[model samples]
Target: MDDNNSFQTLTDYSLQVFQLCRLLWGPIETPKNVQLINQAYFEDQQRRHLLSNWLHQCILSQPQQEQWIMQNCEFLSRGLLNDCVKFAHDEGDLRLAALVHAASGSNTVRDILRHCAHEDIVDVYSKDFRRTIAILSGEFIVKGHNLVDQNRTTYWQMALALHLWFANSASDSVSTIVRDFESAYQEHYWLEPIAHHGNTKALDLRWKLLKLYTDDTYPIDNVFDVNSYTQNPFDYRL
Candidate 1:
């Protein structure tokens, strides 16, 4: 096989394995210590000592473990957002920065959009968001590789659905968000298992928020009429 084909196969295999692992091991929860440490670590000198102690304990508790599996899993799931931010910092990719910031609730997206050149908006909505979505989809595919003998393709589809939910809701109303989410969900019905699985609490939270914002009006449609401002406008094709 050619190098490109080899890489594609490898990626596909990785995704399958990751999905099995998640299914077998279940969702990882954020560590309380990590949260507390992060809070103290960001404080202005007031909790420096506390932060240090927390960090020390974390290190001493598991010298070989860089972070708890839950935290690691969560971070891995957000790999695309984090990478976009890093790319923005390194290469001044404002469009990427904007998308990442918006998805992550960071102020940088607003800051970038405010001062961005007029032409940049199109690039942000079209190129940047599309690329980010593709990258994230691929990442979930890789995550699937860690799974066991289970059918991990469902997990991949679920991850993609979640990504679509976030992308479609970036700046949309509650009703629009629900519509888009339902469309995405129905697009990949195999994800029903993962969606139904108790492991996807975060996905449930997103669904809950959408329902709350939409006043409990859940759209059961297959087509999503998403707003242009949310993610990329459908008019611009790759």
Candidate 2:
């Protein structure tokens, strides 16, 4: 364990980031008055909040820093930004959420995408992503596309990426997102869920909530489907 960054250190670093995010957005402890803070607007206003710079400046040693960077790359690329989008919608701050949403396409995701050789396919994903899914049972190009789980084809990821890319550019204001979110939502509403089944429900919930700012509106009372803001954030849970 001497060579590795202890879990505590990682936890501390994560807490630091969380505090910074909360300070920019709102205090998590007293959310009743957190209001609809725009983290994106305030974040940009901060002198320099570059994750790259933060990675280097932190107290973590080089290996630890490298590890953190790798982990964070995936977090921002797949999770954090998406959570921000969901929170923005839940808090009625679409404009700010839109900013983070815009940032999601940050180069890392694009870089990961380069590894895929097929442009026509992204990964295999079940279409429309229902929580209770049927085994591809029969859609195999003609029928069970016959697998319990499938990654979306490159074409699927490409189309999705493009749609989101355009959505980012078109984001104007909270009011605009009322319609704009739907444009993005149309792609999300029924798109296939990720291939892994381990946390299928949570993953599905996440996607639903991510586009939640879009038209994927869940009933405000249906806490099961979305907006569990009062709960611990993903970082803290880890």
Candidate 3:
């Protein structure tokens, strides 16, 4: 279909879904109520899967219009967005999940990291790292707009994701990933709370060691072993 027709169809259907959501889940009028609503919605796997499929279709139709969908579409509640994020992850589309996380302000990206077992997280990164870095970037294009500066939370989480993967997995490109992360961190270091409660000194020391080790001039073994590191590398302050 043409762009205009596609946009109209999506908007209309989304509105219908929005109404249905309200009727099915009740009013999400306040923060407390929204939380309760999301909890209830989470339990409805059938509905969540349906919503996520529709969301995925919309995203495919307008790949760059995520912010437009999130800002203008009435159907996408935080609950639905979180469901989409989860769906993307389950489908092994981490890039789509990250984009939705950035666009919809969903906590599922961080939530997944926080809730999953360490082995599961390691498995995901090890398998996906060879294929993608869309989740690790600080900047993203949403609805044709360049969002050069993401929120502090998103930036920190992206860094944390990379750090965890790098710590646990062995790869030839890991040093490059470390360098990119350090650059992004330096660029956004002035932003509050990105490094708050994080062990900055340890991070700095590791960066240097990784650089040296990956350079092949020096051998640094077990420096980033996940088992030796703290359970929460960035700390629970987040």
Scored by CA lDDT, what does every candidate get?
0.36, 0.33, 0.38
Global local distance difference test of model 2: 0.33
How many pairs of residues in model 1 come into backbone collision? 20
Please give each candidate's TM-score.
0.26, 0.25, 0.25
Clashing pairs in 3: none
- Candidate 1, superposed: residue stretches over 4 Å from native: 1-80, 83-166, 193-238
TM-score of 3: 0.25
Which parts of model 2 have CA positions greater than 4 angstroms off? 1-161, 167-190, 193-203, 211-217, 221-238
Q: Which digits, one per residue and each the tens of the lDDT, describe model 1 over residues 14-105?
A: 44434433322343344455545544223323222222233233223322323322222223233334654665656666755555556466
What are the per-residue Cα lDDT tens digits for candidate 3 across 1-238?
5769756654654454454344334443334434454554344433333433443443344333344243311122222557666766776877766656664453444344333322234335432331122232322222332232233433333333333332222222434444555555666531322222244434322233334534665545534433222234552221
Candidate 2 lDDT tens digits, 1-238: 3326455555654454454344333422323556647765444333123322332333222232233232222223222446546755676866545545644556443333333212234244323211001211111121323111233321222223323332333334322423443443344432353322233333333233333433445553332432222122353342
RMSD of each: 17.8, 16.2, 20.9
Which prediction has the highest lDDT against the true structure? 3
